[model samples]
Target: MLDHLITHDDNLRMVPTDRNELAAAVGHLQEELRALPEGSDTARARVLTRWIGIAQLCLGHHDEARTSLRQSLELAVTIGNSRAVVATGLNLGDAHRYAGDVRGADALYRSALITARYHHPELMDFALQHTGKHLMECGDPAGARAHLQEALRLRIAKGDAELVKSTQAALERVELLISQADASATGHAVPGQWSRQWTAWLQSRITTRTPSRWAQDFPTVRYAVAGLTAHQRVHPCHLRDQSFPSALLTAMAEEAEKAVAADGYLHNGKWNAATLDAVSLFVGQVDLADVVSRSSGLAVEPPHTAVYIAYEEGQRLDFHLDEFGFGEANLILCLKHERPAELPRASTTVFLTADSYLECDLAAGDCIVFDGALTPHGRTPLSAGESVTLVCFGFRAREQDSRTVTHLPPVPSGRAALGRPESAPAPRCATLCGHAGN
Candidate 1:
């Protein structure tokens, strides 16, 4: 499909697609501009040229985008369209950034901000959104957040739902980056569900990796562990036949599907789904954790959870270790999956042991409990039209080891730990989810 480069409220945005489509678009746009009669409206040509520049930018044709944007700006000035000038300037700044001229991008962003702030107050959000994105690209996510938050506030106040969403998405991207920065600083997982007071925690996102270059070239399945590994206490079980509350998992799966598909409950680049009904279910339901603890052979207290979903082609999780605390043990509930027809044995949660690899082809409401931090595990890639929604609960393997500890006063664990819902006839359940990561 041909990607659209649209201007809304004098701000530039693009629907991204492949380079061939964008290249075709630039060619078509150029032909259209050339077909305009001599002395035809410069304004029309200005818009076309700006679109061409954006298309080229998306195609990674930096010099071409910059040239087209500059030409568009000149036309805007010729037509005395100050709003277009400011808007086109933002694109030009992005071009400069792509061209590795950071100083030029910064200067243009500052100028655009000052002009919009004092002269065109209606365009404040446009200037701020563009500048915030530029700042984020320049390694200043905190600074970016302030600008994006204000832009979001303005867009919301203006009551344009689409504009509000666009800004909100941008803001959420920055928030994820900010969360990543915090994680890097602390040498821990991102703190969405994990508490700061806790010494250890697990996050639902995939691995944060520093790959050994040689290992990247090789393809070996078997791996060995020399350190403290997760001791196998409970066999990896697939609970069905209503033994694992399949009805509840089915209901929760519906809610989780909605959360991921409509609400956007993903981390990393895929973050900021609205926390809807399923989130409330996770926050309030204690029986869920109890079942996980019983099935996994770990006596865990109540646990907090985060979610994961993959929407793109070939999205996968590489093997890696998890942080302590929240990731010590985890129950990964497979809410949904869209396995591709072309790839058999793909897009499943696969874990590695010393001698062999274990692949869990999980369906909805089917969960696997394991030591996430200790096991080098990952989900394989998805093809086009493939997706997966997963919810993860983090807890400790032992009941007494589940307490949250820090410099402050020691506090008990979270709400309702390890309470079975009386579904199974047995008194003692299995272990907790030892594998902590998603």
Candidate 2:
């Protein structure tokens, strides 16, 4: 009976469209489990329960799926089936996540990641990807970037081009959010100009001392320090000299054009006017981690890269702060800027204070490095017949703690972790950008 049930369930999974067949298969599995004595066929019962949960999830019955998965997990634990435990945990997490229980979903995913790290290294990618995706939807781009970057590294190491492409796309979405957040904080209004004497005075004060020392020297300005610890502090922002080689810039620009043609432009809404993915190859080829480390005075890792394209008629980026994780430091390389000869040149501006802003009209191949997470910056909107393409690479400080780090307390027993099933209607299926709970 167990063998027949397993075979039938497998068939149903392969051809999931037939609701009647799926219902019949689930019924048979439930009947078989019921006929067996308690604990008599634990392993078989676990398989049946897990398959039933999967079937329930596929049919959009998330509550039933949760119940079945909880039972399946309990059985797996009882049998010491490590592989089954990991698999069931991931599925259960997805069900919870898609059902609008972000905290609950994260709890499950963290557990799965811990389990996989110890017992099933092969499942690490899946655990990370799902967890990252969940974090991204929850408005934690930094956390999402950390996991997604790690996942991308693993995929690239394994030479899986398809997975690499998908992971890269996910990272791009996170970057767009970070840019938008920074724009919102800075505001779109044109800032007033500062006198040259004022600019020189501020530069002299900061250039001669470390950020921590500067804070101490100017105690009154310390209140504006944003959020930097003395021990691992660096300047809030700085520009690097000739960061990108001319040839590399040209290659990156070509790559961006190709990607835009293949993937089409992504409308990011109030964040980026448009974006292109999988254009980070050149960035990865360079020793960006080292550059960021030296420039920011913090141990940093290689960047997660993307190409941002702004159109003449597109919306301008608003002033906002970057989230902590991937936004610790960012390197933006201007690739191509084509504008009408009659219009004034456009520039990227960083707001230093209410009375002053730093604007740079970067030529092709020029790059700027800044503490994106702590500073507010945005670009002036392009004029008619103007378009600009930029290669953006974001690096995280190695010593900086990730904001998503959570202490997972021990979960109580089966179904209790999810609380009693709610009377509320099941959530709609998860969408790409919205809440994962479907």
Candidate 3:
């Protein structure tokens, strides 16, 4: 569909601007939105509205796109659509940029980025690219490079050829600027101390911690895993006491580490079966029930689990909570590249629980737990590679349901010594089944 749109969209793009093809598309989408039953899957309506925003943007209707995107974002939020929010945020920022408000555009881009960090690292590539472009436009090539590198990492994971090509083009521009800065006394394009400070502050707001008290007030958790069982070895440039994979975390970690070592980007980056397999591996590790409960303090029953994966640069899943059946427990896990940080905190994991919100700073090898039933969850855009995570749902079981429940191994004495409640934690041994990888 995207390919078709891209080729055919040129015709639409070529239409006379005065004739207003955007309004026609907007009208068609509005009709679609109106025809859907009130409260019928909002996802569809949101998606349609997103297309309308795209059309509006392509047709150079920045104001219309902004209006439509705002409405779309409101609907997404109403429907608990995180992906939609991210999409709308991106569109809104783009509208601002095209409308010649770079600062506003940057702010909106940053907001979208902050939202994306919580869901999937895959879409962060697109968000990063756009944000990087914005940063470059704002005279911060270093920040642009940082985001572009992340985007490139995700795209490499996804094997997205077009994105890699375009992103490389952008990177080349930044590289040239850096080179020029090095060669000329007054041409230093790298960010100054103040820009670095501001960027760091912005990152901390999104990746390191909850941006606002409101987010902290409503907490949710994301659960993800990889069935990595082998030890890989690596000398740590930062950690003095331990080398990576001197004890391996999992076989999967080898893939991740390899990608990271290669800087997590592909040369040609054409989306291929291998990239799909990587995404599958990522989702296979997702445990939605565990994510929801740990983050929101909610309980999930057994017998209902589901997972989905998105692989396109623009492909996205909207924000939503499973309110019916076994979907009560939900969470999202993002497989993203690790950033080099002195503190080892590279990612920000947001837990949206009922009446509470918590964003935890994370890095590779760290895990976050949260409840999904109490709060809604979804990813932004998958800009680079396919973002993978398991989405498991557990249903309340009846007394007559005679399923054998495998118990967790007894808590080690040392763990018990850490003051874990014996009876309270006993459920892990019997009630919640530990994963035996496929």
Candidate 4:
């Protein structure tokens, strides 16, 4: 009877199988296992239970899947079936992850990874891929990249074309995210010295091409008429007034430097690539707010101002649209660059698609305004030993009438705001962090 039920379960593994058929098959196998005397055939019971769990998972019954998988895992351990234990561990972890039990999922994945390393190489590959996917979603791109890259290597060596293609697609997404993170120049400037030779090398790469007609006419194109109409807009430097008043530019730069010096750079965990270095003094102190308001034609209050400085080599910002709360109107002022001549002719480039992008070069004090929440923008990697500084300001359309007085909204000043959400139930594995069943 056990062997007949096992055959039925094996047949259900075929692809394009019907879910209803699978459920019925699982139910039939379950009934046969239960008909036998309790505890009479523990090994067969474990395998049957695991098959049932898999069927439950396919049907989106995560709770039932987890319960069945947990029982199968306990039996596998008792029977010293390391391979079954590892497989059950992975399935249980998936069930927990689907149920939003992140901590539980992490624990199970870690346990499976450790157990698979000693049991089967294929099990290890699956564990690595699943763990990497989890980390990628949890804002740990660096960690995810490491795991996925290794998993890809292993899968390729095994000559699994389908798995190779899926892993490659996942890896590409991770690489794109890393590129954007590198291009993002947010955070305070840590005091560091650049050799004169480094500065000279950067300057040598500056483009000295003659300005195009469009470039020359850029300044006259008002921001209100340009970027406000669509998701993004670019205004070239006006030929007549290519720069802001020298005093205002100097003051803004000085304030930026001072803020970095005083507060140090702040790291935002959401995009693990860059940090927030300095913020502009409020509306009353900086004239840039008025400039942005006038140019964008938004009844902008004093903007949330911040200075972003790129510190790492090969760092690039990822392409992403901003959130509405950041502002309806966003302005980026090019305050400083390593080579003035190579400063892009526009603000940071905005991408229309993965393969195409638009950029504008602006001199110090030259600013571009766009619908911050809608534009997908990012920067390229800075050359070795080179750095760029940008002052970012956020503004709302006047009619929105938001009461947000600061760019970084303050956390409510009470204990209620500090409460943590309840965590998921812990995994049953004894040592989730270290070697399991070793």
Best by TM-score: 2
- Cα deviation of 244, candidate 2, in Å: 3.1
Which ten contiguous residues of candidate 1 have the minimum total lDDT? 217-226
lDDT of 1 by residue, 203-313 (tens): 222232222221321122221221213333334444432244455556666766565555453333332232234544554654655675666656665553344444455
- Tens digits of per-residue lDDT for model 4 on 118-227? 45755766788788777776677655765775576556545578777767766666666654654344231110111122222212322112223323322222121122
* Range of the 10 consecutive residues with the lowest summed lDDT in candidate 2: 428-437
Model 3 bad stretches (over 4 Å): 1-24, 37-41, 176-239, 242-438
lDDT of each: 0.59, 0.58, 0.45, 0.52
Off by over 4 Å in 4: 1-17, 172-438
List runs of model 2 lying over 4 Å from the truth.
1-23, 26-53, 56-129, 133-240, 243-247, 258-278, 305-307, 313-315, 401-438
Segments in model 1 whose C-alpha atoms lie over 4 Å from true places: 1-15, 37-40, 184-438
Best by lDDT: 1
* Candidate 3 lDDT for residue 48: 77
lDDT of 1: 0.59
The TM-score between candidate 4 and the true structure equals 0.38
Candidate 4 residue 368 C-alpha distance from true site, Å: 46
TM-score of each: 0.42, 0.46, 0.42, 0.38
Q: Write the per-residue lDDT of candidate 2 for residues 165-267, one digit (tens) a residue.
A: 7777777776677657644554421111111222333343332212224223332222232222221233434343535566767876776666445543344
C-alpha-based local distance difference test score of model 2: 0.58
